[model samples]
Target: MDIEEVRKVASLARLSLSEEELATYGEQLTRILGYVKVLDEVDIEGVDPMPHAVDLQNVFREDAETESLPREDALSNACKTDGQYFQVPQILDQKD
Candidate 1:
């Protein structure tokens, strides 16, 4: 990548780098891409794909159904209500 292209990417990522730093990163990114190209030529016909760097297992407990609180008790704490539902002020601005 060129220094101008690196500068544009830095601007998008909210980074502030000097012109010398941009020139340095431009060369470094090109070298990294070259290494990736070399890795692309490796053979791995029988390799098993691994999703994670380390193995993991689920540790959650079993779920159980339970009774819930009554609606009257749940709505008892509301400041304003319309018999069965809570009421609140208008959220949006005035409209025509």
Candidate 2:
């Protein structure tokens, strides 16, 4: 990339770069773009496009029916409860 292009990019990103930093980044970006250009020239006639570098598989446990905890037992550790349900402080103001 050129110095002007680097400056424009830095401005877009809200980065305040010095003259030396701008020059350095310009050279680095130019080299990175050069590498990308080289990659574009590589032959891939029969290669299939892949989402990931390695193969992936789902490994999950099978779901099973289970008994649930009793309501009273579940509310036992709660700081505030209305006997049947847990009570919490109001978060929003009441509107008319």
Candidate 3:
């Protein structure tokens, strides 16, 4: 890709790149696209897309609450609290 095209992409992505960084990314992206182009040459008549390379299953346990702190104990760490609730600046309430 040309430097101008690369700059345009950087603008769209909200990126600020110095001249060196821009040149580096431009070269790297061009090389990646060239490799992707080569993959199109491969013929896979009966190949199927796989979720994993090896047989695997979920090993996670079911979600269950083991223990929970009391409301007063949980609120003890807050800088400001009104009994049980935390005292935070209400952004939405001030919008009107």
Tens-digit per-residue lDDT, 1-96, candidate 1: 987899999999899999888999989998998888977677878988888888778778768777787888888999988868899887789573
Error of 2 at 28 (Å): 0.9
Pull out the clashing pairs in model 1. none
Instruction: Specify the highest-TM-score model's number.
Output: 1
Pick the winner on lDDT between candidates 2 and 3: 2
Per-residue accuracy of model 3 over 1-96 as CA lDDT, tens digit each: 888989999999999999998999999999998888987888877998787998678789979988799899999999999987999888785866
Candidate 2 lDDT, tens digit per residue, 1-96? 888999999999999999999999999989888878877777888998888888778768769888899999999999999999999878689563
lDDT of each: 0.86, 0.91, 0.90
Which of the predicted structures, 1 or 3, would earn the higher lDDT when compared with the native? 3
Candidate 2, residue 10: how far the Cα is off, in Å: 0.4
Worst 10 residues of 1 by lDDT: 87-96
Off by over 4 Å in 1: 44-51, 57-96
How would the candidate models be sorted by TM-score, starting from the highest?
Answer: 1, 3, 2
Candidate with best lDDT: 2
